[model samples]
Target chain A: MLKLDNIKTYYGNIQALKGISLEVKKGEIICLIGANGAGKSTTLMSISGIEPPRSGSIFLEGIDITGMPAHQIVTMGLSQVPEGRRIFPQLSVLENLDMGAYLRRDKEEQKRDLEYVFDLFPILSQRRNQSGGTLSGGEQQMLAISRALMAKPRILLMDEPSLGLAPIIVQQIFGIITRINKEQGTTIFLVEQNANQALKIADRGYVLQNGMIVKSDTSSALMADEEVKNAYLGV
Target chain B: MKYFLQLVLAGLTKGSIYALIALGYTMVYGIIKLINFAHGEIYMIGAFTALIVGGALQITTGLSPLTILAISLAAAIFFSSGYGVTMEKIAYKPLRNAPRLTALISAIGMSLILQNYVLLAQTSDFLPFRSMIPNFPFLTPGKSLVTTTQLVILITTVVVMVILTLLIKFTRTGKAMRATSQDKVMAQLVGIDINKVITFTFAVGSATAAIGGVLIANHTGQINFYIGFLAGIKAFVAAVLGGIGSIPGAVLGSLVLGMTESFGAGYISSAYEDVFAFIILILILIFKPSGLLGRNEIEKV
Candidate 1:
C-alpha cells in the first residue's frame, strides 16, 4: 500500500503539485489520469523521491518515506518505470536488464526474474546481445517495463506507458499490465494521459487537474460520469 | 632507419605516459561531465609521494632498487587515490546539481589549492629521482632502441589498458559504472548508490594517474611541484583530442599527439613542438569536433 497526504511540490518558485492526497491498497492497479501539465508525472515523481514534495509526507505500507533519496526509495521495494523508456543507449539489452536487478544479490532469484521478463517479451531475448538503442520503439517499451519488473519490487510505478504507442501495442501493453498484476500480485500505480485505456483496466481512478485531485471514484462510475467522458474520454 | 626507430620508440614511450594520465581525465569527465581540472594536480601529488617514499626508503633501509620502487609505487597509489576521493568529496560532490560553470570553477579552485599545498609542503625546486628499474642486458642504455624505463612504460601501459578494458567490459561494478555514466536517473531507479560509484571511479582513475606520475618521474629522473601543470595540460589535450568521454579515444589521442610532437620536433623545428600539437588540435576540432571516436556532440569543458 502507498499513500500521499496533501503533498506540495515546487520547481523553484512555481508550484507544480499544489496539494495532492491519494492512496492505493495492496495488489490493486490504481491509475491517475489527467491532461498534459496537470501534474500526473509530478505526482509519480514525488512518490519516487526524484522530485520530493516540499510539504506533507508519503508512506509505503505505512512507512514514512518523505524526503528519501531515489535510490533509497528503490531499496525500500519501490520501483519506477519512468516516461520515455530511458534505457541506457550504449548498453546491451542484457546489460540494461542486469542494471534493473542491481540491488539483488541472490543469483537464483535474479535468474528467475530474468527468465520471467524474457518470457513476457520474447523479442527482447532475441535481441539480448544487441545494444538497447538499436531496438524498435515497441521493443524498447517492452524492455523498459521488463526492466522495472526485473527489480522484483513489491510496488511498481509507471508513467505514460501508452504514450506514442500504436493502438494495438497499447492494447497489448495494457493486457500485460493486467496480466502482471493478476499473476505476480504486484501493486501498480500507473499514471496516464490515455484516460480510456487506463480506466478500462484500473480498479479505481483519480482525476488530477492543475496539481489538484478533482475527482476520485471507482472505474465504472468514472466511465459513466458526463464531465469525465467529455473532458478526458473524448467520446 | 636507426634514428627513425629511436624516434618512434621515444614517441611511443611519451605517448604511453600521456595515455595513462588522459584516462583519468576521460573517466572523470564521462561520469560527472566535469573536466576535473584537479586531475593534473593529483598526478603531481602522486609523483611527490613516490619521491618522498622512494627517497625515505633509500636513507632508512638497505632495500633493493626494485623493492624501493615497488614500495614507492604503492605509496603513490594510496596517496593519490585518497587525494582524488577527498577532492571530489570536498569540492565537487556538494556541487552535484550546480551549474556546469560553477562546478568547473570549483575544479580550477581545487587544482590551485592542491598545487599551492604542494608548493608549501615540498620544495618548488626540481628534485632528483633515482631510476630504480633494474637494468637488463638487452635493454642496456646504448645497446637497444628502447631504454629500460621506456620498455617498462610501454609494457606497464599495455598491461593497465588490458586490465581496464576487461574490468569495464566484464566486471559487475564496471558495468554499474557504464550504466551510471549513461543514465543517472534510471541508474538510481535500479538501486545503485551513484555517489559510491562516483567515489570508486575517482579512486580507480586517480590510481592510474598515480602510476603514470611515478613512471614518468622514474623515466625523467627529475620532478618539481609544477611538473603536473604541463603534463596535465598535455594529457587534457589528449583526452579532448580522442574524445573526452571515450576511453580508447584518450589512448589514441595520446599516441597521435605523442607521435606528432616526436616527429615534428625530430624533423621540423624542435622549438615549435608545443605549437605543432595545438595546430593539430585546432584542425581536428574544426573538421570533426566530436573527436575521432566520440559519440557525444561537442560541449567544451
Candidate 2:
C-alpha cells in the first residue's frame, strides 16, 4: 500500500500538483484519469521520487519515503513504467529487462522473474535480441510494463501505457495489467487519459483536473455518477 | 617505398595515441552530453606524474622493456584517474544541474588551472624521459628499428581500447553506463546510481588519456605544461570526425587524422599539416555530420 499525504510538486515557478492526497491499497489497480496537464503524471512521479513533492509526505508500506532519490525508491520495491515508454533504445529487449531488475541481488530469482516477464509478453521473448528502438509502439509499451514487472516490485506505477497504441493493443495491455494484478499480487497505480478503459479495471479511481483531485470513488460509483459521466465519459 | 613505409609506421603510432585520447572525448560526451575540455589536462597530469615518479624517484628498473612499460602505464592510469574523479566531483557535478554552457566554461577554467598548476610546479621548460629507463628496440626491420616507445604507444592504445570496449559491452556496470547515457531518468528509475556511473565514465576516459599522455611523452621525447591544449583540440577533432560519441568512430577518426597529418607532412607540406586535419573535419561535418560509424539519432517531439 502507498499513501500520498498533501503532496505538492512544482516545475520551476509553476505548480503541477497542489496539495494532492491519495491512497493506493495492496494488490489493487487504482487509476488516476485526467485531461492534459491534470497532474496525473505528476502524482505518479511524486510517489516514484522522480519528482519529489515540494511539501508533505509519501509513505510506502507504512514507511515514509519522502524525498528519497528515484533509484533508492526503486530498490525499495517501487518501479515506474515512465511516460512515452522511455525504454533504452540502444539496448536489446533482454538488456532492457535486466536494467529493470538493476538492484536485485539474487541471480536465480532474476532469471525466474525474467522468465515470468517473457511469458507475460512473449513478443519480448521472441524479439529478445532486437533493439528496443526497433519495436513498434505497442510492443515498446509491453516491454515497458514487462520491464517494470522484472523488478518484482511491491507496486508498479505506469504513466499512460496506452497513450499512442492502437485500440486493440490498448485492450491487450489493459488485460495484461489486470492479469498482473491478479497473478502477481502487484499493486498498480495507473495514470491514464483513457477514462473508460481505466475505470473499467481500476477497483478505485480518481479524477484530476488542473492539479487538483476533483473526485475519488470506487470504480462503479465513479462510472455511475452523472457528473463523472458528463465531465469525463462525455455521456 | 621505404619512405612511405616509415610514414605509415609513424602514422600508426601517432594514430594510436590520438585514438586513445579521442576515446576520452567521445566517452565523456556520450554519457554527459557535454565536452569535458579539461580531459586533455588530465592526460597532461598523467605524463607529469610519470615524470615526477620516474624522474625524481628513479624508480625505473632495467629488467625487461615489458616491466617498465607496465609500471609506466599503471602510474599514468592511477594519476589521471585521481585527477579525473576529483575534477568531476568538484567542477562538473556542481554544474551538472546548470546549463551545458556552464559546465563547458567550468571545464575551460579547470583546464587553465591545471595548466597553471603544472607550469608552476615543473616550470615552462619541456622535459625529457628520465634517462634511467634506457630505450630498447621493440620494432626492428633490418636497418630501421622502431623504438620501444612507439611499440609501447601502439600496444597501450590497443590495450586501452580493448579493455574499454569489453567494459562497455559486456559488464553489468557497462550496461548501467549505457542505460544512464540513453536516459538518465529511466536509468535512475531502474535503480542505477547515476553519479557512480558518471564517475566511472570519467575514470575510464581519464585512464585512457593517461596512457595517451605517457605514450606522447615517450614518442615525442618532450612535454610542455600547455601541451594539453593542442592535444585536446586535436582529440576533440578526432572525436567529431569519428562521429561525436561513437567509440570505434573515435579510433577510426584518430587513424584518419594521424595518417592525414603524417602523409601530408611527408609528401605535401609540413606547415599545412594542422590545416589539413581541420579541413577534413570541416568536410566531414559538411558532408556527414555524424562521423563514419555514427548512427543518426532521431528525436521524437
Candidate 3:
C-alpha cells in the first residue's frame, strides 16, 4: 500500500501539483485520470522519487519514503515505467531486462523473473536480441512494462502506457494489466488521459483536475456517475 | 623503394601511438558526451608513474625489453587509473549536472592544473629514456631504420585496439557503458550505478593512454612536463577527424593524420608539420563534418 499526504510539487516557479493526496491499497489497480497538465504524470513521478514532492509525506507500508533517491526507491520495491517508454535504445531487449534486475543479488531469482517477463510479453522473448529502439511503439511499451516488471516491484507505477498505442493494442495491454494484478498481486498505480477504458478495470479510481483530486469512487460508480461521465468520458 | 618503405614503416609505428592516444578521447566522448580534455594528461601521468616505479624498483634500463615493458605497463595502468578516478570525483562529478560548457571548462582547468603540478615537480626539462631498444633497420639494411621501440609501439597499439573492440562489443560491462552513454537516466533505472560506469570508462581510457605515453617516451627517448599538450591536441584532432565518438574512426583518423605529417615533413618541410595537421582538420570539418566514419546523429525536436 502507498499513501501521499498533502503532496506539493513544483517545477521552478510554477506549482505543478498543489496539495494533492491519494492512497493506493495493496494489490489494487488505481488509475489517476486527468486532462493535459493535470499533474497526473507529476503525481506518479513524485511517488517514484524522480521528482520528490516539495512538501508532502510519501509512505510505503507505513514507512516514510519522502525525498528518497530514485534508485533507492527502486530497491524498496517501487518501479516506474516512465511516460515516454525511456528504454535504453542501444541495449538489446535482453540487456534492458537484465538492467531491471540490477539490484537483485540472486541470479536464480533474476532468471525466474526474466522468464515471467517473457511469459507476460511473449513478443519480447521472440525479439530478445533486437535493439530496444527498433521495436514498434506498442512493442516498445510492452518492453518498457516488462522491463519494470523485471525489477519485481511490489508496487508498479506506469505513466501513459497507452498514450500512443492503437485501440486494439491498448485493450490488449489493459487485459495484461488485469492479469498481472490478479496473478502477481502487484499493486498498480497508473496515470492516463483515457478515462473510459481506465475506469473499466480499475478497482478504485481518482479523477484529477488541475492538480487536485476532484473525485474518488469505485470503478463502476465512477463509470455510472453522471458528473464523472460528463467531465471525463464526454458522454 | 627501400627508403620509402622504411619511412612508411616509421609512419605506421608513430601512427599507431597516435591511434592509441586518440582512443582515449573517442571512448570518453562516446559515453559522457563531453570531450575529456584532461585525457591527454592521463597519458602524461602514466609515463611519470612508469618512470617513478621503474626507478624505485631498480628495474634498470639494461633489462629485457619485454620485462621493462610489462613492469611499466602495470605501473602505468595502476597509477593513471587512480589519478583518473580522483580527477572525475573532484573535478568532473561536481560539474556533471551543470551545463556542458561548464563541464568542458572544468576539464580544461583540470588539464591546466595537472600540467602545472608536473611543471612544479619536474621543471619542464626533457628526460631521456634509454635508446637501447633496437631501431631495427631491416628494410634499409645497414641504414637507420625504424627501431624496435617503434615496432613494439605498433604491435602494442594493434593488440590494445583489438582487445578494446572485443571488450566493447562482447562484454556485459561494455554493454552497460554503451547504455549509459546513450541514456544515463534509463541506464540507472535498469539498476546500473551510473557513477561506477562512468568511472570505469575513465579508468579504461586512462589505462590505454598510459600505455601510449610510455611507448612515446621509449621511442622518442624524451619525456617533458608539457609534452602531453601537443600530443593531446593532435590526438584530439584525430578523434574529431574520425568522428568524435567513433572508436575505429579515431584510429583511421590518426593514420591519415600521421601519414600526412610524415610525408609532408619529408617532401615539404618540418616547419609546416603542425600546420598540415590543422589544415587537414579544417578541411575535414568543412567537407565531411562528421569525420571519415562518423554517422550523423539526428535529434528530433
Best by lDDT: 1
Candidate 3, residue A122: the lDDT equals 95
Number of the predicted model whose DockQ against the real structure is largest: 2
Question: What is the DockQ (computed on Cα atoms) for candidate 1?
Answer: 0.63
The global C-alpha lDDT for each of the candidates, from Candidate 1 onward, is 0.91, 0.87, 0.85
* Cα lDDT of model 1 by residue, B118-154, tens digit: 9999888889998878897776677677888898999
* Residue runs of model 3 more than 4 Å from their true location after superposition: A105-109, B59-68, B131-146, B299-301
Superposed by TM-score, candidate 1 places the C-alpha of residue B214 at a distance from the truth, in angstroms, of 0.1
Error of 2 at A19 (Å): 0.2
DockQ of each: 0.63, 0.81, 0.48
Candidate 2's error at B95, in angstroms?
1.6
Task: Report how far off residue B209 is in candidate 2 (Å).
Answer: 0.4
Error of 1 at B5 (Å): 1.2
lDDT of 2 by residue, A1-235 (tens): 8998999999998999988889999989999998998988888888888889899899999999999988889888999998999989999999999998888889999999888988888989999999999999999999999888888898999999989889999999999999999999999999988889999999999999999888999999999999989888888
Ranking by lDDT: 1, 2, 3
Provide candidate 1's TM-score on chain A: 0.99
The structural similarity of chain B in model 3 to the true chain B, as TM-score, is 0.93
Q: Which has the greatest TM-score?
A: 1
How would you encode candidate 1's per-residue C-alpha lDDT over A1-235 as one tens digit per residue? 9999999999989999989999999999999999999999889889988889999999999999999988899988899889888888889999999988888889899999999988888899999999988887778889999998888888999999998889998998999999999999989999999999999999999999999999999999999999999999999
TM-score between candidate 3 and the true structure: 0.91
Worst 10 residues of 2 chain A by lDDT: A41-50
